[model samples]
Target chain A: MATSEDGDFLPLTPVAFDILLSLLGGEAHGYAIMRSVQERTGAEASLHAGTLYRALARLVETGWIEELERAGSDESDERRRYYRVTGVGRRVARAEALRLENQLGAARAHGLLGRA
Target chain B: MSHRRRAVTERLYRALLLTYPEQFRERHGDEMTRLFLEKGVDARRRNGRAGAFVHWLSGATDALRNGVGERWNESRQSRREAGTPTANARRTNERGGGGMDSVLKDLKYASRTLLQNRGFSVVAIVTIALGIGANTAIFSVVRAVLLQPLPYEDPQELVLLWGELRNRGITHFPTSPPDFVDFRDRADALEDLAGVSTFQASLTGDGDPVQVDVGSVTPNLFSMLGIEPVLGRNFVEEDGLPNPQGALPGQPGVLPGIVILSHALWQQRYAAAPDVIGRSIEIGGGPAEIVGVMPPGFELLMPPTAALTPNVDLWTAARLDYVNSPRNNVVLRPVGRLREGATVEQLQAQVDLIAADLMIDNPIKATAGYRLRVENFAADVTAHVRPVLLALFGAVVFVLLIACANVSNLLLVRASGRDREFAVRAALGGTRSRLIRQMLIESGLLAAVGALLGIALASGGITLLLGFQPADLPRHRNRSHRWTRPSVHGRIRYRRGCDFRNGSRDPDVQVRTRRRIEGSGRPLHEPVPKADQERGRRCGGRVVARPADRVRLDGAELRGTEQRAAWIRFRRSPYVQRRPSVRPLPAGHRSSGFQS
Candidate 1:
C-alpha cells in the first residue's frame, strides 16, 4: 500500500519497512521521492530504474496510490507527474506502523533491546 | 503474410533478437526475436507507436541484461560443477604475476607471423624505411637550421645591434664605432658591447706562407660572446694600445702586435702545440705574439653576404689611438649580451635613447639612423637558408607520399589473400577487434625493419655530401653549383682558366683565383677581332681529333655557292687521320684556322 510519505521512501530500495517509514509525510513526484528516500537513508539504499518505475505502476494499479493532476507551469519542461496516498494507502500505512510497534514492545519485554 | 510484409517483419524481429551474448545468439537468438516481434507488433496495433517503441525497448534491454548475466552466472556455475582446483590458483597469478606472460606471448606470435610472410614483410619494411628516412633527413636539416642552441653561454642574451638609417630609407647597417662607444657609456641595460671588422693578414712566418682571414676587434669581443681562450689567454686591456708606426711599446723597434689563432688553424698549422703562448709569428708584415687559440666552430657574427669568406683565421684587438680614429667609419659589426633581467625590447629602447643623443652630436650620421635593433646570432646566420631547406623538405615529402600509397596498395592485396585465415580465426572465437590489433602489430614489425635500412641509407647520403664539397664552403653559400661534378666522370673538373691549381703559371688563372668566381664563370675562347690585333707572324698547329669528310666553307672568292661546294667535296682516304688525344700545350703553342 502507498502512503503520503511513500514518495520519500520510494528510493529506499528492496526494503518495505524503510519505504513505509519515509512515506509518513506527504505526496511527491517519483524522482523527488526517490531523492528524498536516498537522502534520509544516507545513501545506504538505492533503487534501480526498472524496479522503482515497476513498483510505482503496480501501486497505482492497486488503488493504494492516487495520481494528482500536477499544475502546468511555464518552468516545467515535461509533464510533471505527481502522486499521493489514497484512503486505503493511509489505512495500510497506520496498520504497518502498529504491527512494527507491537513487535518492538515484545522485544523490549524480553529485554533483548539492551541485553549484553 | 506476403513476402514483402514477411521480410519487413523479419527485419524488425532481427533488431530485437541480436541483443543476446554470442554464446546465446548462436543457440537461440533468432527464435527469441521472432517470438518478441510477433507479440510486439500486435501490442503496437492495439496501444499505438509510442506503446510499441516502449515495448520493443524494454524487451531489447531485458534480453541484453539477462543474456550477459546468464553468461556470467553459467561460467561461475561450471567452475563449481567441475571443481577446478587451478581456477583459484590461476586467478591469483593473473592478479599481477602472470601479466607479463600474456604480453610476451603476443609479441612472440606477432614475430612468428612477420617471419612467415617474408614477401609482405620486405615490402612493408621498404615502405616504412622511405617514410622514416625522409623524415630523418628533413629533421636533421631543421635541427641544424633551427633546433640546436647557439655556441655561447646564454646565447639568447646576445643580439646583433644594427642601425636603421631612417633618413636614407635603409633598414640595417653596421653601427658606427663612435655610436657604439656612446651607447656603451649611456646604456644602462647592456652588460657588454663589442665590435668586429674583417681584415686580411699574410701569415709570412707560417709553414705554408699563405694569406689568412683576421678579425680586428675591441677588447670586449670574446667576452661579449661569453667565450674563453682554450690556450694561453684572451686579449688584455694593454694589447689594445696603438704603438707609433706599428711598434711595440716595450720593444722599441718591434711592433706591438698581438694575435689570437682560431682552433682549426692552430690544429692544422701549429700542430696543436701546448706552448703556443709567447711564440713570435710574422703576420700582416709585422712580428705578432700568439696570445691564444679560440674554440672550434667559432664563426664571426655577421650575415654571410656575397660569399665573402670569413676573414678570421686569427683575431687582434683594435689599437687605442681612438681619439683621432673616425667613429663615422661604419665598418664594425657589433654584438652584445644584455644584463640579466633585461629583455631585447628593453635593451633596444635603451639603445634608442643613446642613439638619439649621438644624433644631436653628429647630425649627419645619427640623423639618418634610428635606434639599434638586436637579433639572435643563430637566427641572423640561418634566416636566408630557411627557404632552401623548406624546398628540400617539400621534395622529400612528395617522395614519401608516393611510397606510402604504394605500400597501402600492397597491404590491401596481402589482406585479400589472408581473408581465409582471418575467417577461420574468427570462427574459432577471435573477435574482430583482436584481429585488427594483430594486423597492426604486423605492420609495426615491418616498419621496424625499414628503419634499420633507412639509417644505412642516411649514412651513405651524408658521406656523399662530404665527398664532393667545394674547397671553400659555408662562406660561399652558392657552392652547390660548383660542387656538382661532370655528369659522366663524377670528378670535379673546372674550365682551365678558373682552376685554382694553376694559379701561379698563368696570370689569367691568377686573376680567376683572386676573383674566386664559382659556377660557370669561365670565359669563352674566341678568336681575337682582326681590327683589335696586329699581325706579327703566322703560326700553325697539327689538327687533332678530326671530324668526318664533310668540309664546307664560304668566301667571296667562290664563283657561286654551288660551284664552291663541288670543289670542296673530298673522298674518304684509306689512311685514318689520328693524333695524340691528350698532351700538354707547348710554351709557345698557338692555333690557326687552317691547320694542316
Candidate 2:
C-alpha cells in the first residue's frame, strides 16, 4: 500500500474502489477481476449473477473497460471474452487510490491510527 | 454414447435452448442444435466441471445474442421496406427503424401506470366488460332470431294468403273448407295451394298419454312449402283427391295412416330408431304410420316453429271432399306458392275480384265488408317478437356507449393528473404523439381486461335465459321434454330458431262469437253484449220479463269466445224499455241518473 501527503481528495464507494484496485495489477475478464478482488481483501462479497454482469456491461458502456478478442479458441466460445482498462479507467482508479492514501496519511499524522 | 451421458447432454441443451427467442425455434432450431452439440463436445474436452459450466453459459449467451441480432436486422429491413411508398403504408409514418423500441417503451409505461392506480384500472375494466358483454349476448340473440333467413329453399318467393271476412271486420281469417277448395281449384297464378290448422291431441302409444300439439295440413302442404322429408317420403298429389283413403300408384293413403316425426321427437322418444318406417304411433285416438323424420331444426318454418317442432308431435293429412258444405267455419290457415313470374300485386288483384264477386252473390253475409291483403308467411310468424328484440338491442347499445363514455372520462382525468410527468417527458424530447400513444396503450390494456370480464358475465346471462324457458315455446316440447319447476319452465319455451327464442309469437285466427235470433237462425242488428249480464249468465241467453203474463227478450251476444254457445231464458228481465216510476232514495245512498 502507498500513502499520500495531501488531505484534500475525492470520495469513492468501497465496491467501486475494490473493483478499480483489482484491475490495477493487470488486465482481466469479469470473473477474474472478481476473483482478484476477493483474494486481496480476504473477505467474502456476495454478488448476484445479474448484478455482476450488469456492472461489467455498464463499465464497458461507459468506456472504462474495452472488449478484446481471445487469442485462439473455438469460434463458438463467446464466454471467454477478455477486457482491459482504458486510459479513463486508469486515471479514475489512480485518483481514487491516491485519495484513500491521503486520508490514511492524515490519520497517521494526527496520531489517530495506532494511538486510538 | 451411454444413455445417462446422453440424457445429461440433452438436459443441458434444453436449458440452453430457452435463451433463444421463439422465432428462432420455429425457423432454425434443428440447425442451431447441431451447432451447439459440435461446440459442446470440444468444450467438455478442454474444461473440467467449472470450465464446462462456463461453456454452457457461453452457449446460452450466444443464443441470446443471435436472437437480439436477428431482431435488429429485421427492424432494419422493415425500415428499408417502409421507405418505399407502399399502398398500405401509414401516412406520416413515425414508426421508423425504432418502432419496436418505442412500442415496448409505451407498454412498459402503461403497465407501470396501471400498477400505480390499481383501483381505477379494475373499476374501468369491470365497467367496460359488463357493457360489452350485454351487447354481445343480445346481438347474438338478434342475429339468431331477426337477422337469420328462413331455413327454406328460395324462401323469398313464399307468401301467406289471408281471407278477409268483410262483414265481421275479421281480416286474416282462416280460409273455410269451401273457400280453400275454390282457391285451390280456381286460382291459376299459384303453383299450389295448401292449408294448415292447429289441434291438440293426446299421444297414447309408447308412453303415458301426454298432450301434444298437432298441426293438421292439406296433403299438398309440404309440396307448396318446398320441403321434403329427410328420412322418407312426402305426401303425394293423389292423396288430396276427392276419394277417401285413395291409393295412387307409388303412394300409400290406404290405411289413412301416414305421418312424419320431427328430429327432436325421433331422437328423444324413438332413440333414433332407424327402422321407424312403417311403425304405428297413436295420435288423437287414431293410429298413424310414421313415414319419415324431418331434418333437425326444420321447426324454424311453420306453426310450432315451422311445423317441424314436436309442439305438434304428429301431423295428419286433411282430405278435402266437395260435398262437405261448411261456410265461414274459419278453421284453416291457407298458404300458396306463386307461379314462376307472378307477383303479389297481380295475385292480389285476382283474389280481390274473386272476393268481390263472392260478396255480391251473398248480401246478408257481406253487409259489414272487409279487405283482403297478402303477407309473407315468415313475416307473419316473426312479427310478434321482432319489435321487442329491436328494443332490447337498442337498450344494450346504449349501455355499451355509456361504458365507453365513462372510460373516456376516467382516462381524461388520469391524463390531467399525470400532466406533470408528461411535461417532464416532453421536455426530455418525447413527442406529443408518443405521449398520446402511451395513454392509448393504457386504455387498451383496461379494455382487454374489461372484455374478458364481460365474456364471463354474458355466459352467465345466457345460462339464466335458457334455464327459465316457457312450455308453449316451440323448442321445448315432447322431444327433450324434461320438467323441473313450473316457474322455471314458464319462459315461453323458445324455438331453437331465433324467432321464438327471442319471445316472439305469431297471431293465429281470431275467434268472434255472436248469437242468432230464434225461428229463422238469422243474426240481428243488436247492441254489443253488456258486461254485467254476460258475466252472471252463460253466453247466448235471453232475458225475459213477466209483467202481466210474460215478456220475452233476446240475448244475441256472448262475452267469452271459447265458451260453447248456449241459450239462457231468464225468468224476469231487470231493465224495462219505457217506464216512469217514482222512488225516493236516502241522502247517502243516492242514485245519480243521467248526470249530464
Candidate 3:
C-alpha cells in the first residue's frame, strides 16, 4: 500500500519519473542509469552528467531509492556508487502507471487520444 | 592524447567541482570526475578528434548549471527545515539588534544570499563587468589622448598658427619659412615663436642602423617653453643656424652640428651614461655631437597636422635662412607663446593683419586666397581626436546604462519570489526601513564584486588595446598604469574650454564659405573640421558631417591650383634622401602631419 505521503510525491516530474523507472529493473551505478534513461528517452544524445547524479541523490534522500554498500563490481574503484529502488518507490511507480492508464482510457473514450 | 594531457584534464574537472556544495562534492565528486574521463574517452573513440572537445564543453556547462541548482535547493531545504528567516548570524543578534552587530549580521546574510543564488549572481556580475570594463578601457584612451592637460608651462598661453583659404576650404596649412619669420617679426601680440618639424632619419654610426624620429626645432624653443635638459646644456643660438647644406638637405652645407638625445634613447643606446654628452654619433651621414639629454617623459604633444609624435628620439636645432626662403614653399608648423596678459584673439587679429599685408604685397598670397587663424594650442591639437573619444565614451556609458537596467530587472524577478520571506521578517518585528536596508546590503554586495571584476577586466583590455596602438591615439600607449578618476574630470572640463571656441565666427569667411558651397555643382568633398561644421550651421551652408581622409577639394576645385602654393617637404640630408623601404602609413591611417 502506497502511503499518503508517498502519493504527495506524485504526479512525478518527468526527470524523476525517468530516473525511478530506470532504477527499478536492478541495482545500477550512475553511468548505467544515465545510459538506460538516454536509450529509453531516445531524444537526448546523452544524459547530462549533473542531471543524472542530482536526480539519483534526490531519490536516495527521499527514501524512494537506496544506495547499496557495494561501490561497484570492481570493488577497488570507489567511484561507481550503485543504487536500487525501494519497495515504497516501486508501489508508487505502479500507482502512477495505473493513474496514467485511467487518464488515457478516459481520453480515448472522449476521442482526445486515439489508437495509432 | 598523451597520458600527461589526460592527467591535466582530470585536474581541470576536479577544479570545476569546486562550484558544487561541499556536501555534494564529498558525496559524489570522485564519481563524477571518473565518469567524466570515461565519458570523454568513449565519446572520442566513437566520434573522432572533435568528440573530446564537445564532451568537455557539455560536461562543464552541465556541471555549472546543476551545481548552482543543487546549491539553491540546498538553501531552500535548510530554510524549510529551520522554519525561520533568521540564520545563525542573525540569531546571535536577535536580542537588541540595532547597532554594529546588526550591521554585521546583515552583511553576512547578504553575502549568504549571493552565494546561495550562485547562477544569478555570476550572470549579473559578468554583465556589469563587461560594460564597466569597456568603459574603463575607452576612458584610458581618452585620458591619454584628448583629455590630458598639455604638459607645458602656461599651456593656455601657447597657440598654433595656421594659414587658410576661406574660399578654397583649405585651413590649418603649415607656414612657409619666410612667412614664419615674417609672422615672428610682425606679430607683437606674441612674446616669442618656435617651429618644429619631424623627419625619419637613421642613426648610421651606432651599433646598427636604427630608424629614429628626429625633430628639427628652433634653438630657443626650450627656453620659450621653460624646459631645461636633464643632462648637459640647452641649445645655444649658434646651434640654431641651418646645417651646412644651405637652405635644403641636398644643398652644399655642413650636415651635422649638435643633437639632443631623448631620455629613452639615452637609456637604450648609451645606458644612461652621464659622460656620454660629448659622444659623436653619425646622423644621416653627418658626424653629430650629443649636446644634451632631454628629461624623461618630455615629448612634443602636438596635433596630427604638426606630425610630432611623443616618442621623438632626437632633437636638432634648425639652421634656417629666412631672407632667402621662398614664400610659396610652406612647411614649418610653429607654436607661439603669448606675452603676459596677451590673448589668442589678440594674436589672431595680428595674424589676420599680416595675411592682409602679404596679399597686398605679393601675388602668390592673393592667388592662393590666404586667410590666417590662431587656436589655443590644447584645443587645436585635440580637435580631430576629441570628438572620437567623446563618441566612444558616450557609447560605453550607454552600455553601462543597459547593464544597470538588466540588473534591475533581475532584482525585480528575485524580489517577487522573496515576498514570503520578507513577510516573515516583518511579522517578527522587522520595520519597513530595516527590510529596505537589507535589500540595500544585498545590492551593495553585488556592486562590490562586480566593480572588482570589472577593473581586472579593464586592465587586461587596456593592455590588449595598447598592443594595437593606433597611430593617431596620443599619450595612451606609454602610461599603462594611468587609470585615474581625475582624467574623467579633465574630460568634462576640457569639453567646456573647447566648446566656446568652436562656435560661430567671421561672417566674411562664412560668406566666402557660402559662396564655395553654392559653387560646388556636384557633391565633392575634402575633410573639414568639426568647428567648420559648426560655422557652416550658422552660414546656412552644407558641410559634409563626416568626411573621409581622401581630400578632394584642391583650391576649391579651382583651375590655378599650383598658385595654391606647394608645401614642399625637402628631405634635407642626402643620406636621408633614400625613400623609406617600408610603405607609407596605409590608407585610412590617421596622420598627425598635414596631408594633401
lDDT of 3: 0.69
Q: Which residue ranges in model 3 land beyond 4 Å of their true spot?
A: A1-116, B1-97, B165-172, B204-211, B242-256, B307-310, B467-469, B478-596
lDDT: worst 10-residue window of model 2 chain B: B495-504
Poorest stretch of ten by lDDT in candidate 1 chain B: B488-497
Q: Which docking class does model 3 fall in?
A: acceptable
Error (Å) of candidate 3 at residue B567 is: 66
The residue pairs that clash in candidate 3, if any, are: B241-B319, B242-B319, B244-B253, B244-B254, B245-B253, B249-B572, B304-B592, B305-B592
DockQ winner among the candidates? 3
For residues A3-37, write the lDDT of model 1, one tens digit per residue.
Answer: 55544433333444344445556766555655566
If both were scored by lDDT, which would come out higher, candidate 1 or candidate 2? 1
Q: Judged by TM-score, which candidate is best?
A: 3
How do the residues B1-596 of candidate 3 rate in per-residue lDDT, one tens digit apiece?
67997899989988888888999999988888877888888778878678888988899888888888898787556545753444532543443445554677788888887787787799888976776677778787777777667778888899888778766777767788888888999999999999888788888776888998888888978888878999999998888766543444334556565899999999998899998788878777666888999999897877776655557999988767667767877767788999899999888989989989989988767887997789898888778778877998898877765665455445544553343355445445454546656777677677667766777888888888777766766666444545473344234222222211110122233343344435432232344434443332322211111111001221122222231232111112122222233223222211111111
Off by over 4 Å in 2: A1-116, B1-105, B185-189, B204-210, B241-254, B300-310, B322-325, B340-342, B361-365, B368-371, B463-596
Q: How much lDDT does candidate 1 score?
A: 0.56
Model 3 is docked with a DockQ of 0.42
* Model 2 native-contact share: 0.00
- Cα-based lDDT for every prediction: 0.56, 0.55, 0.69
Lowest lDDT 10-mer window, candidate 3 chain B? Answer: B541-550
lDDT, model 2, position A109: 86
Listed in order, the DockQ scores are 0.01, 0.03, 0.42
Ranking by DockQ: 3, 2, 1
